[model samples]
Target chain A: MTGAPLLAVNNIEVIYDHVILVLKGVSLQVPEEGIVALLGANGAGKTTTLKAVSNLLGAERGDVTKGTIEYRGERVEKLSPNELVTRGVVQVMEGRHCFGHLTVEENLMTGAYTRTDGRGAIRDDLDLVYRYFPRLQQRRTSQAGYVSGGEQQMTAIGRALMSKPKMILLDEPSMGLAPQLVEEIFEIVKRLNEEEKVSFLLAEQNTNIALKYARYGYILENGRVVMDGNAAELAANEDVKEFYLGLSGTKRKSYRDVKHYRRRKRWLS
Target chain B: MADLFFFLEVLIGGLLSGVLYSLVALGFVLIYKASGVFNFAQGAMVLLAGLTFVRLTQILGSEHPWDGMFVLALAITFAVMIALAFAVERVVLRPLVNQAQIIMFMATIGLTFFLEGAAQGVWGSQVHRLNLGVSELPIIIGDVLLPPLDLVAAAAAAAMVAGLAVFFSRTRIGRALRAVADDHQAALSVGIPLQSIWVVVWSVAGIVALFAGLVWGAKLGVQFSLTLVALKALPVLILGGFTSIPGAIIGGLIIGASEKLAEVFIGPLVGGAIENWFPYMLALVFLLFRPQGLFGEKIIKRV
Candidate 1:
């Protein structure tokens, strides 16, 4: 990994309709070949943070009000999503935003649309993607909409990979996957980080697995980064363990461990 | 049974008329493909083209005659259509782009009325005979004699359809138009000039309408009522799918043949005027089974 950071997101405030402020004073840094997890409860502005990075905020009716995102030491806050894509910053959106009508191949080709590279290179990339997910190669001709959820998630990541992005902003990659599939998806993410050396800023509610894979983590609470440190440090913190890790007592659950939290539990204190 | 020859003759004549119907229908498809607007102004554009053709020929002088005069007149008309297309794109479509689809559609209808008024004000209310300079002589093959005018009309329609098909498939701009039809946002993201594409589409539509005008005007002469033929293209659109080229051609052929057959066989039984309603009824029937039509892809909306 390079000593120079690949992406530096400064304090950014995002406002909605020029009135309601969704995110206030949010900042994070991601170095090359590193995994950074943005952890938050629902509506805590995790998705908004990713959208701000990818320039997809405008489509969802949100705008960055302050600060800038620098990629390769160049300002990119006001650049359009299409422009950001050419600059090698891409997003595998929150929902599996596959072009439903398009075939899996066509959907992937859309990723390399900004490339003027020869067709052979595109074909090589397609083969590389298929190697990562053999199931996708088998169903390459099928329309994306008909794919199973796990396959759709794979397709979304594969599509983003076709762009050969230097960094990927993955929003909730484990959102709706089954337990086994979630494990499989995270394994692939880990493999991608290790093998491809691609940087990732993953926004996930699946904190246990996210923390295991990330080198660093940031816990966002109501649009503010309440805790930011090395992944091991944040994971071991008692407050984070209670609120995010779903841990109780001395015996902590392993990855995929699920324990429910009640809002009234805080009220008891 | 004794009227078999007469029946065949009427069938042939109606088929010729169908070619003209398809031509106008092609205009509707061009605009729909490029801008997703079923331009109601197409009918008025037809009437205006006929009027303009006549006025230009008159100014060119009677000595030059319509044969050479007609081509020169069309060149001038082409220039005018380009200007009209640019004006429509700049004035109507650009401002109304982000507006609702129905609002943009209604605006085109308003444009139809405006063009109609402008045509009358400029060309004046008069019926002028148009001779496209094709021989009035009929080709007699055995008992079946085909009028040269009908032959020219059908040939012209075929030529235009072929030209459009080749242009769309072979040219980059045409492919861009197809891309625009596929996804407007995607097309815009690719750096395509959306407003300019609209202008090109409308200009092509104007040209198609003018071609229909020249042929129809030569057969029935130029008159304001000729604009009613544009309404006939609606059934064509319903059958062909809004954006398919081959669909337009096939749809036009179907409407033409069916309307002719209905008028010949069914018109007598139903007190005539069946020609006016047959295409519409066929379109209505097709819509009942396939709302997207023969060639149109089914649309799925996501919330």
Candidate 2:
């Protein structure tokens, strides 16, 4: 919201298989050393926005047909995902995709694949990752497939850290984890932001947690941004409270009452 | 005592032959690991390498008996293998990126035919002698007899396997390859170039095929039928799993030894020639218990 944004996605449209339009005129930005949260329900183009930024759309036969994506003052719409990694923009994909067969350490080393730095620097970075996610260091030699879901998520983030990225596009970090684990992971993300100064544009369905951690938040519905504001403002908004946080400001009511009350909202109608 | 000694000879011989089968199967495993393509052209590639080496050797030998001619012939053969690697990567793999696995597999089958035809067309279908300077005479070791050529092949296969083990585990490219094998998209996300990895992998597989061809052609001859030896590697692959390098080696040894032993012991019960179907039968029976093969990871379907 201040100086030039670190990453700016400008009115991008994505189509899959040359037929189905997935994301329509989606736009958002993350300033340098800032965390932005993309909040949406299922099928709301949250993941698509992340993919569009990282240039991973081509693998799934999806193309960014309209608009542009800029990172660090350079247009990155046409670059390959690996090229983006070289420029220090990395994405942790939706499903916590750890190389299941590789050892946990091997998975982390792969994150450093784009870096030309010497072994000593890479090792120091590995130690830095371990300090953040100590669980990963403990399971460093275990096959990633055998690790627990929380550990796998840590490995994914740790692997991203090995690249020494300037920013990370995190997709659904709290997808299948317990609530406590989710909180723990988000705290580390917060610490990393504050200490390492790595920016994050995380897409999350858990709006309560996402907004709590992110400095700025954007809410998407049906492939378009419906609302956005500062974290505190969005949390205090009435519509977001009822729909996203499931918090009804008024008195408690039965299921039928809630359904009837929801139909009365102007946005839903 | 004499019969016991003969049995020992057969077992040792079978193991050595199994090493040869592993060599060819290694070619399949390398390509399959990198690109997820079941390269049916591996056999034809082997044939092409062998024929090219032998043809070059003959032409150069006829000119002079100089030792440099042999080195030149080998150098030319290596260049041919590298050229084939580039051609396959560019023409077959790059265009077919992100296609269905079955479609890629079928493309490799088409590649098999194309390569087979090209090899025959260019080198002529006549059988050519391949002498890699290894003696064909059987060497007597203690009470058992072994073919010196088989010993050489086993040593070569062992060295190649060791080299590959070091490559996959220690080197950066090797680690990237293992990552590519795990998940192509994840590998791409980490900034590994999928196309270049495919080319490097295809080139390595080509080199493996060339070595396989040299050994097999020396044992038999550089004829069209030499391509059919790749069929032997199929059973090896089925037993070893399509993805495991060690699986290929072990599976090759199992198939090679079992087929030969069956031919020696069980052949008399049947009308003989059980070698033709023994490995397949063994693989089928083995698959009945472990469908993923010896080293292949068990597929866990998550809803």
Candidate 3:
């Protein structure tokens, strides 16, 4: 919010199979080289929103039915996913779907498919990825499917890096990783953002760590962004802490006294 | 000594014919690996390719065969196959992009019938002779004799496989194709154009079909029955595995040699013409031992 944003999603809605609605006029922004967290529950449409910006909705039978996504002050929601990549935008999808059959190095090489730059640059990028995730270089020749989950995530991110993207839409980087690994990955994400000057719109369910690393956060609930604010402000908010962080100012109440607290949870969802 | 030379002749011929069958199976494997579709249209595509090439050669000139329009016709027919790939990509694959694998499978089955009818509609149903200019008679090698035509066909098939292997290993697009084969969603996220990959794969399959057409058309005559020759590759695919390149070649060799051996040695004991169904019987038995075949990747089952 200090300067013109790099990406702006203006009240976009998504629907699947032309019947079931998903995102309901949701909007968000990422400033140049910003780390913005899209925090939400499982079905809060975090992945949907990331996919919408990457134009990957069509692959999943999902369509952005309303509003627009602008990148670098241009309407880019209409562009194909690969075309978006050529414009230096890439997404690391949830689940870290690496090419299981291919070696990790081959998987990284595939990211440069659209790049017209020579092999020397691609080779340099490969080395750069290895520098960031040194573990990946060790496992580079191993089949991606056979590698550990953390390595797969690193390979996915490293693969995105090979594309030389200006921005990365990362969905659920902490989905199944241990908390220690999550912190390590976020540190790398921070490094990538700062060093590469690549903006990030990261969608996650782990709000505390996400807010710790991100400058701003948007908390989505049931397909709409229910709340958004500066990272510190949102983390401190009582509702956000109580609901998302499993935190509350008050001490734990008696089981008998708060048995109907389920009422509150049900109402919030 | 005579009996051994006769056996060698049968074995060499079987191996050569095996190479040709592998050519057909290669077409199926390429499309299947990229898109997860079985591409039932592959056999029909071979027929279409043969019909188009034979018709083109006829329109141009078949008399000179070497210096004249035969090479020109080959070039033109290849262009036609590429054009057909573009049309199939736009009309068939794009609309059904995210459809289930079975749905794509059904479309290919539909495509099989459509291509057969369309090719026949355009090129006519009459059988045409395809002379590849190679001598059909056997060349005497000391005591053993080899069919010159089979040798030529084997050489051509070998060349195509080598080129394709190089293409897959050394090129960027090849790596992208393998990525698509591994995971479609991830591939798309990495900016691999799935549609463009499909077009390239289908065109490559088309090229495979064209070469198959030239060999089989010369052998069996360019008739609708050329499709049946392609259908014979089904057993080759089953034995080789649907997703492997080397599997297709090895599977084709196994099927070819086994069928010829069965027909020559076992046919007398089991009545006759067992070669027609011998490979199928072998594949049926193969499925019992290993459902994934020799080279197909086994589906990992997590506990």
Candidate 4:
């Protein structure tokens, strides 16, 4: 791990539309050139945490009511999302929100909107993305909406890569994909971290896949981090194995293990 | 031969007017495409731009058409439109960000009434002549005489549409715009500023409004009635697909040519004034066949 974390979320609290609290005191960090995963199920404030770091919560009428976010040791809680991008932080939102109307290449091009480095550099990066995602290159001219779900997910990640970010805040990269596709994407992510040197703060519900790749992991539940540790440590935890990994020392959970293995003796019994 | 010439003239005239309708609809498409707001106030924006231009020209002395007043008034009126766009973005859209699409639509409805009243109150409800220096005299071509003013207006509209089409397809800013329109959250996440794009789109729509206002004001005379031209564009938008730029132009052309042909040929058989309601009937029928409109993205259902 690097000497200092690349990105830090210091006890942030997010509230939507001034009423509903979403993320409550969520704190996490991504070390430089490290893959850190934020693990959770639906409504566990996983997406909200990533959005807070990227400063994208404002558009959804969401406010980071408390705490500060730091990127490269500079406070970035109040910067506009684009400014954060300029400073080398990009977020690939969940649902693979590729521009449905645009061609795959065009969707990737939009990622370079704020780039003043001229077309040549952007073009080189585009070719780089195509190299990393050969499937995207094959479907370059197709409308993104018409592509398979896996391709759309790849396009979303490829779009994020177009920005040439120092760090990526990727939310639910494996959502709604098949097991094979999920593993394939995580594999590409690991390579990007190693080769491109882009730090990632990944949010995922697929705990088994995430723990397999991520160097560190934080488990969130009901708007707060329930546990956090090294990937192997988190993977070996008995509760994590039972709830998230679905592996109570078996290839798959049997009916009894999944349902009611803990039927204990009560006073009446 | 004489009947054919007359038919040709009617067709040409209708097509020319239809291009003007497309001009107004183009403004709506810009805002709608970028931010998903069906800006009902586009007509009001047209009225304001027309009034602002005509009054400024008179205030600066209208006799100096080739020299001082015309270009100066146009520039000033365009500035006013941009400023209005900025103000609307701040006052109307900014607060209402993330509100339901229907609520935004309704806000634009309120904006329509407010702007209509504001334009009249500020400029006074007086009819003013707007001569864009295009000669009103008809030009004879073979057996038919064509109005030069309508021809000029059609050319201007064509040029603007071409420029916009190229800008959207060829430029980075344009791609960013489409991205913003497709998904605000994703756009922001990828570093496209949602609010800035909104302001730019509204401003571009404002520029379009200025051009539309000038042409329509010249043809119909600048007055309260100028706002009603926005109504003509509605049928055009429905036919073109509210989200597509080329659809607006094509829709406008279809509406214009058909309504005129229908009015001329079918009017005698029926009562008359088919021009009054023909476009709407056509648009209604089109909705039945293609709800997304020509060139509009198909509405995909998950079920």
Candidate 5:
């Protein structure tokens, strides 16, 4: 928590369709040049929190009704998603939403739409992205829809990198990828963070992989932060271990059996 | 040999008329690509452009007996189209953002009525000729005949298509437009302003409409019937698919040629005027075989 945080969400509450409260008092921060993970299962408001920061909630009839999201010390609640992007904060949405009709290079070039830089710098950035994800360079001319799932994910991330963004909100990069592909993608993410000094706020369901790469982590449950600690500390915590990591002291019969045994929750107390 | 020459004459005439239909259809494709709205006002925009050009020509020609008046009139007409583009973007499209595609489509239908009424109110309801200095005489090549106006229209359409192709592929704004066409959310996430893209697209559509208006108005005169050209382009759109530009061009050629050929060959069986419904019937049969239309991307559904 030294120096100013790159992005800070203060007790934000999001409501969808003006009635359904999706996120109730969720808060987190990513320091400058740091990688932070927002770990949660489905319906836990992880995506909602990320969307709130990126100002993308308006597209889905959702709004942050309470609290503020400060990026670079400016209140971003009123800013549009494209405005946030121009300010060097961009989000790679879930489901690897690549432009299916465009070629891989065209899709990547779109990320630099707001950039006022010359062609040589943009080309350098493309080469930089290609260096990180060499597989993308080989399939650069192929239509993004025709590429494989892992390559689509790389194209999505590479597209974000082309923007020269200071921070990226990555939502479920490993959602549908195989285990080995997931590891490879996370390894590239780690390399980008270490080499390019880009900050990341990753919303991930893969708690084990996320905690391994993230410097700090926040565990969300039922739209609230249930726990927050350093990555190693959260990895060692007993509750996170039993619920999220799926590891136990002794061999359990099944997840259902563990649920029956932990019917009376410790975290809720 | 005489009958064969007649057949070639009819075929060439049909292809030339197809160029006009493609010009109108290109307006629809531009708006639909940028906003996903099937713009029914395109025909009305064409009518408006023709009316503006005719009225401007008369006004300028009457005031100044110089030849530059026509060029000035053309410039004024372009400015008017740009203003119309801004008006449509601000008044109609801006408020209707993120609405359903059907709702936007309906809005454009409403726009058709308003534009038609406005054009007639401003320029009077009388038919007016648009003379772009092209000779009306036919050129005789051996046994075949070619109308000069039709040749001009085809050349104009080809030039416009080539220019549009370059715009879409080579220019930055054009590339952004293609991205917007592929995916709106992805385009927005990359810092492309959706609103500005819509404005640019509507402006481009307006320009296309103006060119169509000029061509069709020169042949048929600017009248209430010009509004019906939009209805004609719908069948062209159906034959080509709603989303494809090349589809629009090919669809226009198919509809234009088939309808002409059917009118000449099969008109005796159906008692003539088969030109009225032949394109629609042809589109229906084509849709039955390939619902996506020729050159359209095959839709892939994922659960």
Candidate 6:
């Protein structure tokens, strides 16, 4: 309750090959115990922002040209992905990224890669992850690739939990899922947040569902934040409504007009 | 009758040689399985181990007799291989872990050149006799004369393969290695130190290489020419899956037997030197039909 932000993503810009400016002046904060959501459309640089923060932006070929990322007030911009994991900054990545040949249990065990706890303690936590995700326990010995999409997503999140991370940067947890599964996944996320007090900064395209779980939210459009506030406030905003909420308003026409206007602005610039 | 006996002799000889080839191939499979890198320098590592054993025996046992010299030489070589494995892991593999597969593969090729030069620099470029003194007398039972050295090579290869199988399937370190081989990122997340696993694998591969060198040296005098024996292993690998130990063994036996048979029965029809190209030709045919090799996992590419 009385400490610096768990993670501070200051005005950072990420460019791919120095030409494809993916993330332009992006910034966000995750309090020690809060669920922060990053909402954006496809290719809105949500994943890029997470990658940049994780110090895993694939070197100069995919560089974060500007801005600073600090975790617990320590600059982690220059650290390797493994170093970031060691510092307890773990990302559950966009896709499941589960080891296809490994069992669900093995996959979960990998999450605790950075941990140096006793085997029994690790086993106890693994049981806890299984308790939270019963389906994984049921299919513990099964190959991860053979699991259903929903189950794979659960395994991914569960794997990250094994690390006992200070904060998790979830990239599109609900991607490529059935609606019911999406709801189930988000419900689990909400439960995890309330029960464990684990911090999360989820990048998601499903605004309606994302807003339901996130206490605070930032809306990204074309690599920049156009709207930011409490989830409910932003959910109610005209711009957020017109663009993401599918609400009919003058903001809808203006949003579409800006796309056309941006081309002209680009030409002039 | 003499012609048939000669045919059988060559067949047995080739099969024995193939067993040795398979042993070397197993080393390749172990490293490749743990890490996706083909470890093109596996051949060089084998030659290096062979040279090291010869040099150690010469330098360490010159005053002493050759009684337990073979075992002592092997022990020294094992230690050297382990150190070499660590060096390669820290210096060559660790930095190139995130690089492209091609780059990693090329780096191993470079490693091959470095090892070859270093081996020659250390052992010099002379053929030395390694009389394993393990009863080279051929056991004659009925009409068959089986060389004890050949029997030792075959048994040793089988025993080593079995031992490796048990190590991988039953041990925690082996399980961790398999996990790293399956998915490096996932393995990292689980807290498996990839560097440690790579070192262990390379060390194990090095041990296997030394064992191969010993058996092979017993049959053919140890020299730079010993490295050329590793070429037969390539065909064995092509026949066996890149990561499959059994594939290497079976592929080796087939290549070894076929080449000898070709030399004995088919050599007269095709002039000579069929032994040189027979394994490769067999491997090329296997490749055309089953590119994944006998034991390799089939990778289906989808658009």
- Best model number under DockQ: 3
Off by over 4 Å in 2: A263-269, B62-66, B300-303
lDDT of each: 0.81, 0.90, 0.91, 0.89, 0.89, 0.82
Candidate 1 residues A1-269, lDDT tens each?
A: 34768999899999976788988899889998899999999999998898888876665467898988899899999887767777777888776766666667766666676566877998898898898888899999887778888888898888788778788899899977898998988888888888988889999999998999899999898888888899999889877888888776688555555435332333235
For model 2 chain B, the run of ten residues with the poorest summed lDDT = B294-303
Residue-level lDDT of model 5, residues B146-189, one tens digit each, is 99998988987898999999998777788889889888887877
lDDT of 2 by residue, B1-303 (tens): 889988989888899999999999999999888888889999999998999888898888744333788789878989888888888888988888889999999999999899999988988999977777876678997789999999988998899999999999988899999999999989988888898898788888889988999889988888888778989998898899989999999999889888989999999999999999999888888779877789976553334
The fnat scores of all predictions, in order, read 0.01, 0.67, 0.87, 0.87, 0.60, 0.29
Docking class of 4: medium
**Each prediction's DockQ against the real complex:** 0.14, 0.67, 0.76, 0.74, 0.66, 0.29
TM-score, first chain, each model: 0.91, 0.97, 0.95, 0.94, 0.97, 0.89
lDDT of 4 at B207: 93
Q: Of 5 and 6, which scores higher on DockQ?
A: 5
Report the error of model 1 at residue B139, Å.
4.5
Best by lDDT: 3
Candidates' TM-scores? 0.75, 0.97, 0.97, 0.96, 0.97, 0.87
TM-score of chain B of each: 0.94, 0.96, 0.97, 0.97, 0.96, 0.93
Residue pair clashes in candidate 5: none
By the DockQ metric, which is better: model 2 or model 6?
2
lDDT of 4 by residue, A1-269 (tens): 54888888899999998999998899888899999999988999998998888888888889999998888899999999999999999999888988988999999999898889988999999999999999999999999988999999999999999888999888898888999999999999999999999988999988988999999999998998888999999999887877788666657656875466743312114
Candidate 6 lDDT score relative to the true structure: 0.82
Model 3 agreement with the true structure over A144-262: per-residue lDDT tens digits: 88888899899999999999999999989997899999999999999999999999999999999999999999989888888899999999987888788877677865678556663
- Model 3 lDDT per residue over B158-177, tens place: 88889999999889988889
- Off by more than 4 A, model 6: A1-3, A15-21, A58-66, A249-269, B1-15, B62-75, B94-97, B140-143, B166-173, B185-196, B265-272, B300-303
C-alpha RMSD of candidate 4 = 2.7
